[model samples]
Target: MALPTLISAAQLHEILEQNDLVILDSRFYLTDLQKGRQQYELGHIPGALFVDLHHQLAGDETEQTGRHPLPEPSELADTLMNLGIDSQTQVVVYDDMGGAMAARAWWMLVQQGIEVFVLDGGFPTWQRAGYAIEAGCNQATVAEQRLTISYPWLVSEDDVVANLETERFQLLDARAADRFQGENETMDPVAGHIPGAVNRPFMQNLNEHGLMKAPSLLLEEWTSLLQDIEKPIVYYCGSGVTACHNVLAMNYAGLEAKHVYVGSWSQWAKRILRKIDEANA
Candidate 1:
């Protein structure tokens, strides 16, 4: 059987010595692009490789692709191969910011049917538990591999536009209330969210300890939002990063939110501006 989607720090510590295990530290700060690598060099879980959200997980920023577009499939595949992560390697990803950043790696791997896990509560939880921590960069033995990849859970910007008219998917925004409400606008040019999308901040998935809420509680909360709505659910957030957190939470609670708008609001807002400019021209 495949490993569960989430693993506690203690559970991960037990499997630390497994030959097939590959731990990835995806810690990132949206404001400071290089901070993730700096933190990784300072300290990280033993045998872990650092993956920068900007360079590794995301592709070049373009007018059409948004701030943090999904990396080309081959790009990530090559990175994994260089990390010696072949088909048999089991992956575990964690971040300092709860599971917000780590969930990005987890989502990408899971979509390819790879048996990967997000460290419950992430790196902070592991540190709190007094686990072994290593400093400096850890290198992997590179191996030759060509992985077959697919994004079954991804939805394109065009699909989101179409949903505005059809309502086939119940769109949810994973950004905070302030951002969703068009206040304190900073990241993107325009404010607010795509039409028909409701706010469901990703932080709601965590508790006072910054750990995930119990499965029952998660299910109960999701049930209230989904009551009698049969439409398939989709999630999006600024730059398509934190959105994965909500997706992970829903999946952990035994609910399916298989569709993610990878371009998310950053792309949507930019495209809206281009359209307005064209009309004014």
Candidate 2:
């Protein structure tokens, strides 16, 4: 049987010595991009390679694009090959932020039809378990074969707008409740959400101890929110990062939604604000 979408630290420890396993340290901060690498150099899981969220997971940003846009499929495939990832590799990704950033890599890889899992409880859990840690970078030799990405899992901004107009799908925002309610405006110029999006903060997927909730529990929570709505559900976050966390959780709970808004709230808000500015000008 294949491994589930989420892997425990114990399961990872058991397979840590396996040659086919590839662990990635995805520790990242939205405000401080270098903090993740700095922390990785201080200490990380043994044999784990560091993946910078900004450089590797995201693409160049512009006023029209979200803060952390999805990288070009071809570019990301090349990067994965350079990192020694191949078709047969079993990839495990983790971050300090309760799988927020790590889930992005997991989602991207899974979208490419690659088998990958997010480390449940993240790096803090491994530390709590007294697992061995390594310092400095561990670069893998570039692999000869490159991976291909087929983004059947992603939804474009146009899809979001159509969903809003047609109500053909449910739109879920994974941002914090306050942010969703437009209470605290910091990340983007606009305060509110994409008009009809329901706020289901991604952090709610985790327990108070920061580990993911049981699949049964998650199923109940999500099912209730979804209710009788039979349309395909779409999820988004500030810049499409944490939204993957919700997608991972839903998949673990057996309620997988393949459509994710890659540009998310940041791009949506920007476009709305720009249109308003243009209209006034």
Provide TM-scores for the models.
0.97, 0.97
By summed lDDT, the worst window of 10 consecutive residues in model 2 runs over 1-10
lDDT of 1 by residue, 1-281 (tens): 23247899999999999998999999999989999999999999999999888998889999788788888888988887887777777899999878999988888888776778999988889999999899999988785666876787889999998888889998889999999999998888999989888888999999988888998999999999878778888889998889999988988888776678989999999889989999999
Identify the runs in model 2 with alpha carbons over 4 angstroms from their true place. Answer: 1-3
Give per-candidate clash totals: 0, 0
lDDT of 1 at 84: 76
TM-score of 1: 0.97
The residue pairs in collision within model 2 are none
lDDT of 2: 0.88
User: How many angstroms is residue 48 displaced in model 2 relative to the true structure, after the best TM-score fit?
Assistant: 0.4
Candidate 1 ranges with C-alpha deviation above 4 Å: 1-3
Error of 1 at 57 (Å): 0.5
